[model samples]
Target: MVTPAVSGGDLARVAIVGASLGGMSTASGLRGHGFDGEIVMVEAEAELPPDRPPLSKQVLTGEWPLERARQPGSATLDELGVDLRFGRRAVRLDVATRTLTLDDHETVSADAVVLATGSAARRPPIPGIDRPGVHLLRTGADAAALRAGLAATPQRVLIVGAGFIGLEVAGSARELGLPVTVVEAFATPASRVLPPAIGMALAAAAVDAGVDLRTDTSVEALLGPGVEGAAGGDGDAPVAGALLSDGTTLAADLVLVAVGAVPASGWLSDTPGIDLDDGVLADATAMAAPGVAVVGDLARWWHRGAGGFVRVEHWDNAIEMGRYVGARLMARDDAEPYTPVPWMWSNQFGAKFQLAGHVSPDDALTWIDGTPEDRAWVGVTHDGTTVKSVMGYNRNPKVMRIRMRMDGPDGLALVDLLAAESTQ
Candidate 1:
């Protein structure tokens, strides 16, 4: 129920909250859509430089630099005449007043507001969780801190969760000559994202990297045996020891939690009608509130074709959604909704994994390229009769083919095409 705010007149002010991937994408999208009105961007992160997924993969492994991972869009804002507030986290949203309140008690007025505040890495809830050696890679600072920890004499490192982040960390840790152990609640790494068959391949890569993997294992608790001979025993949140469900206690000099992240939605507490189900609710047009619309991760609006509002947290979704939101804001006329194919990538153990389309848990999976033993292949997920998604390991060409079939209704035939290629 978006309030039809027929007010605000010609000087409609649009405020986009966030400085990271979501914030930058939203602001840039507005400009691309020909939005000439006043546009303001709010972000709490320290730097405007982009810190992408590669920072956790290649940056820590001495392959890429801090300067290389930046978003490469701050200069574009100046050219687009966008006002940016860097290093300031917006804490509240007053939809009635069309005002966004910041943690610093600053109130920003706008006719439309988009909450594109993205997500951060989650830390395991445990005592001494904030210990000196315990690290969570959410920002550039976190990655830098973890990098420094790895440089030390390389004691036993414990990583909780074998998802994309966890596996990537384990790969890097092993590559650096550090003894690492990975504990996952699921039987295989990335089981939630990929089918069990495909996930087995990813798990093998982690094992190949000398990662001690404990499947179907959960940490009953995080314990702090206290840092070895530290000056003082400040138990605090810093953890030095962890207790597993199997009654095993491991001495951990360094522990990393790469579980997962959710959208930061504390600011949208009372801002209803914008779609707050998992994220801010909005349509394909990115419209949330009356004059306000949302794009990127926070826009949780549904799609008729996909069957629901998908707040996809991937690289392509952010860019594609932002482009749609921006173009609609500028057109000032009837515009088509965005129905983009979701795509994401992860680099681990010298392997590159890419995916296109939305492959859900309920979707039927059929392997089409490479083989499980070969450590390489492409897979497609079907929605009964149509190819809904395509995933691959070192298979970009196949990924491209699936991308072409995404918007068309004839995608169901993709499954046959992939099966033929797989046999070849």
Candidate 2:
């Protein structure tokens, strides 16, 4: 069954069970690289997949239509001779036989399989969270519904988390003149993703934009519009307010729960040879099992350059990983190891925050340009003397420039690089 794409001879068939950005990219890459095989992409969602990042910003803000947000090169799937099965869910994977059973009882067997089912938004265990006005945005439909709700002119909007999505949504709400209140258990917005100083600066940016940023705050329960003990509306109401852990109730016409997301890997539970921790355990080349590759958010692969295993959720990482895996599958010789300089950007509170490479909050951060108070800076992280990561707060050009020179022997020193680049 191994073809030149997978091992040598010509590949006959390949099946991708996801139809997400990664899946789309993999399919395109396979065909583009002369792998004249029968490519099939199965997707659970009825509508064709769209770029998800815009779901929180432009799509919700009515600046971009859903159709406009379709994944890049999506239209050429048909031209590439790909069989796209929409609304088809992969229920089980039989690795022994290399077969995938769909929900409709149809089985698609292929020489190689790529699992990119992506992730689903996490819904916390808050009481009354199932109320009509409480929403979670993850998909296109979710974004549309949230936008429709916002169109009704809500008195106040309460967001349950201060992650990237939560803050972006709050910014969108403020743009619509809706009073936005963000409740985060952490001390600052984007605390988990960015350095503490950068996170605090982002929190200030949100507040400056008229957001009622509530850090160190947790929503104990969601009160219904009609609950007996709930504040505001009676039993007929949808969601009236949220009860906070600090003994207070915040009235809201709509509540968005942006806690986070979990990998959508339940279908691969019984599949042999595929290690699943938080995601599908794959090698640097995204090889999950023999003839099986995993990408996107559901792949936790050993990064050759990073010196560790990381599961990146950014759009760029998904595209790059998919392309790398596709090329690896097609080549007769083993392709170069998958070691990407991961990059991601967030649009929050009318600022563009771009990050290149990886950095933990514990890493030593040296501000290369501007101050946290100025809300614009380029920062670099180091592991003792070697540069580990770089971040830009409204410094996209500098970040892009600095990231280019980050992979050499002399590039280990961040302070020297900053000094040299500043003079340029």
Candidate 3:
């Protein structure tokens, strides 16, 4: 990395690292919005980028072929005049001179730089986490390894953590005719996000699909890879079983960890004047540096509804925030501000879940629809009667109309609209 005191520029020579969703989207969006400045992208991967979301879902299940997931060609990049430095890893950033040094020692300079490198999967410190039959999904390799393990049609599977990833894995395992048991330290599936009632319903769905759901438990240690369980899955203590923190044991041949992810902002930690919180901090406009900006899961800006700084890690946030950051970059004024409602989706069973707006951490959650027992549900999150957020499970259209209503006055009058959708 080029280390210097400070550099000066009016507009900017922009460089984006990580050709992931946020980075590529920002490059494409900026050009679309008429940014004429010289732009370059640094991608760390060896081959052309492959789609990530499918790696854990359709790709692993053989529902979709791998080629379908590859990102579109650089024709878009070429049309936008983006110089893509592929196969180069960005090792460090020098905030003093505003330059990034690649693994090859080649330095790229930018007046403003956005750190959109997303997070990685966390690994357990246990002795056997690195052994075969254990899986962690974040990159394609991790998913591919887990996919190979699942291909054998093992009778038993063990999943750690019931967060989005873990549940998705359990759902996939069940789909493949495996008897899966999920172990979560939390009390319920997605306990962090959903209410107790909703979480139980979700857990029940997994159980209904033949999952041996174990909640409020954690793995104390992982045993040797050589010890396959009685069911022939990777075993602990001669039989594939996990030493649970509660003095209990659960057996399975395969183990998957899906606890959570930390922000991929460690490289920028030494970069001076860069505001670092849960992720790189951004102002209302998503600007963390003058002539520079941040977006996607890595950009932690103040969420109005949440009343605090939060990093919204969802596909929509990455896309919408990238577009806004690009537009702001192209405007050449660094003045216009844009904000979008945070939204995310998960397709586990035949159900789809969606949330619009930010839900307060401590906000009171009222059922717009009755409760999670119904396959379809909606919750109106309130901050003193002003509906800050409206979340739905299979009621997206109703949520859309409610958002329209909140922005208008019809929403307050048409509170009865939720009742009809609740029965679905």
Candidate 4:
């Protein structure tokens, strides 16, 4: 059992940065844990933070209204006695004093501070990237702009990455009958997360859906209009296409750069004692300092299961970490190390892909229920002994059950259990 970092009674006020899903979750968890202290949430965006998962699918496809993507409204936070500070960005932090300097030059000092600044979309240092018609989807504004761009009906849609976001957007584009081309630097789509076999199987579905999936390809540069053979723009105007490393140029009226994101930890660069290596470093208890806790994508904390520190940017991780840190701060739950089986899901080509627990490309994967060719399967990955992760495509029930077992002793005996079930 880990010891609580700060007692509930000692916390007179708590200041949360980002107002992201994780930040909001922390605030709500504190209130739910009976913390009557003042709760202040400072967000860089003036409007309420919107749910991001929908931005790629429903929001992009115009199936869901943009207003429906909002997580919790001001009224909801107000009911919990939260002091919502919208449009206020934290520019600096003094961990020792538990004071945060906002971009507006206002200093907010609290008994405890929670860092949930999250991440920002990574825009590669390529020329013509700043031009119109080239978009990076991270925020609600980005989604709206991309959606509007799609409404304009570009002849060719080019996505510069085969990550979840890029693939989901590709599926959405295809659903609108637009010609989509996805370029991935890796051999498979979502190679950073999914194993090659699984990614290739999903890539087949995208191809079947009329997406021109290009693997092992990279975008050298975004070609602006007036370039030789560039389409859809006048001289020196919006992005007309891209120059690939293979010496091939693809004409794209619209380009979505979904390469990846980086932790929003630049403000804490000068802050002493806070280790900033890719993200804000924290202990297994999610505590960064005596009264400081870091949650969400910005937290790079020790994972007992992984045997090292990991920074998870998934939506579920944000919620779980927020609740755990909140309970720890208030001393509400047993002092247990924050160890969670990281889970993430994506929707593409009308199939739901779910992955639970940390997985590596090198992990040995075995199909437990169905084959990948079926486009609906449940598989588990193992490190020669214990199961490390479970992934499924449209097999939610089996995948979830296996995922739940991963936290128990049965997880280690999964192979034997599956063998036994197979004989029956």
Best by TM-score: 4
Alpha-carbon TM-score of each model against the true structure: 0.90, 0.94, 0.87, 0.95
lDDT for residue 416 in candidate 3, whole number 0-100? 51
Candidate 3 structure quality by residue, lDDT tens digits, 279-395: 888777777765457778788986544456778888767777877777666555544444455666666655666667666445677787656777787877765556666777788
lDDT of candidate 2 over 1-424, digit per residue (tens)? 2212354355688899998889988887887777887888899999787889888888888898877888888777678787888999999998765699999999999888889899889989887777888899888888889989888999999999999899999999998889999999988777776778878888888999999989999998788754345443443458878888888888887999999888999888867877899899877678887778888999999876777888888999889888877787787546666777788899987899888887787788888788888888888888767788888888888888877777553455756786696786
C-alpha RMSD (angstroms) for model 3? 4.7
Q: What tens digits encode model 1's per-residue C-alpha lDDT throughout 190-209?
A: 77777787788888878888
Q: Return the TM-score for candidate 3, rounded to 2 decimals.
A: 0.87
Predict model 1's lDDT versus the native: 0.73
Candidate 3 clash total? 4
- Residue 94 in candidate 2, Cα distance off native in Å: 1.5
Cand. 2 TM to true fold: 0.94
The digit string of per-residue lDDT tens for model 4 on 317-407 reads 9998998878888983346788899899999999999999888887888888788889899888887788889999999987887778787
**Which model, 1 or 3, shows the larger TM-score?**
1
Q: Candidates ranked by lDDT, best first? A: 4, 2, 1, 3
Candidate 1 colliding pairs, count: 17
Ranking by TM-score: 4, 2, 1, 3
* lDDT by candidate, in order shown: 0.73, 0.83, 0.71, 0.86
**Clash pairs for candidate 3:** 229-240, 233-253, 234-253, 235-240
**CA error at residue 338 for candidate 3, angstroms:** 3.4
